[model samples]
Target: MLKTILSISGKPGLYRLLSSGKNTLIVESLQTKKRIPVLPKDRVVSLGDISMFTDGEDIALSEVLTRLHEKQAGVAVSEELLKDSDALRNSFGEVIPNFDRERVYTSDIKKLYTWYNILIEAGITDFADQDEAE
Candidate 1:
């Protein structure tokens, strides 16, 4: 699930891993369904590999997303909330109460919401890894 989804730096949206070659990985845009080759120089990060800073320990992105889903009742984050930095902080606080305020910037919150909404639109409500779920 999250393992196959990648975030390529400099790309506008999330991409789904399609295939791999010797020096490039094929990826399909989750938004437009367009296929493109990700070169070796491109910074590609798997969604599963992302984590958020917390007061005690780092929390996996999947866990944060799951908490967000439950908090929002699986609905997309509101545009109004997204626009206000304070509101975004407050909302994320509700999702992850102990999230490190100093480490998690407003931009990170915005990106998290954007990615969550995109995944919801793509009909991917399950954020947990299959092995973890079992």
Candidate 2:
């Protein structure tokens, strides 16, 4: 689930939380399956904790991803779309029509697609929490 998938700042890719110690947390890279110790000083954010700005209220990243999954039928976003800002925005708008245009930058859209691709490549298609799925 998204809760166990972490995005550590300054790191290249997503990491899966493995264990915790008194001083550091153990994480395995989702991309390479390499384990690393994350210090307390490192900014670690779980994907479940992320949200996107919207007109009414913020939408959870997991929900956004789920919507995207449904919209694309699990197909990964095209590389050409990723590079073109207009195309990226158009694609994202189709998935999340009300995502705050002012707050969600082009970089954020690209990252969303990138993360979605990574998760898909890792065989993680379920973005909903277990409780929510039930």
Candidate 3:
């Protein structure tokens, strides 16, 4: 499941973008000039490479997830069968808090595969602005 999620949402701006160890989340704003800090569980517009090179450190999606957890903000994995842009636009939703195996088991496996492939097929791959912390 994790592999599938990464494979599809791997493209920028289509999921709850997370870094490896940061304390902030990079929520894309359509009306602002900066990526803001959101609760870990906050659904986000993850359509680009949200990584940042601050001073010298590289901030990647993995780091964002770490930070989200530290902030104690809830994050939900959206399985919504939406268009690429639509998926990015409404990325913010209820966070799941924790992804226990039992919780995932509740969903139908076939459905999961469908959503995963859809993203992989239609997700974007350009505009990964590295080092956004400039």
Among the numbered candidates, top lDDT falls to: 1
| Candidate 2: segments with Cα more than 4 A from true spot | none
Q: Against the unseen true structure, what C-alpha lDDT does each candidate score?
A: 0.95, 0.94, 0.34
Distance from true location, Cα of 118 in model 3, Å = 16
Model 1, 1-95: lDDT tens digits are: 99999999999989999999999999999999999999999999999999999999999999999999999999999999999999999999999
lDDT of 3: 0.34
Give me the displacement of residue 52 in model 2, in angstroms.
0.6
Cα-based RMSD of the predictions, in order? 0.9, 1.0, 15.8
Q: Clashes in each model (backbone N, CA, C under 3 Å)?
A: 0, 0, 28
Order the candidates by TM-score, highest first — what do you get? Answer: 1, 2, 3
TM-score quality measure for candidate 1: 0.97
The candidate maximizing TM-score is 1
**Candidate 2: residue 115 Cα off by (Å):** 0.4
Q: Who is ahead in lDDT, 1 or 3?
A: 1
Tell me the lDDT of candidate 1. Answer: 0.95
Better of 1 and 2 by TM-score: 1
Stronger candidate by lDDT (1 vs 2)? 1
TM-score of 2: 0.96
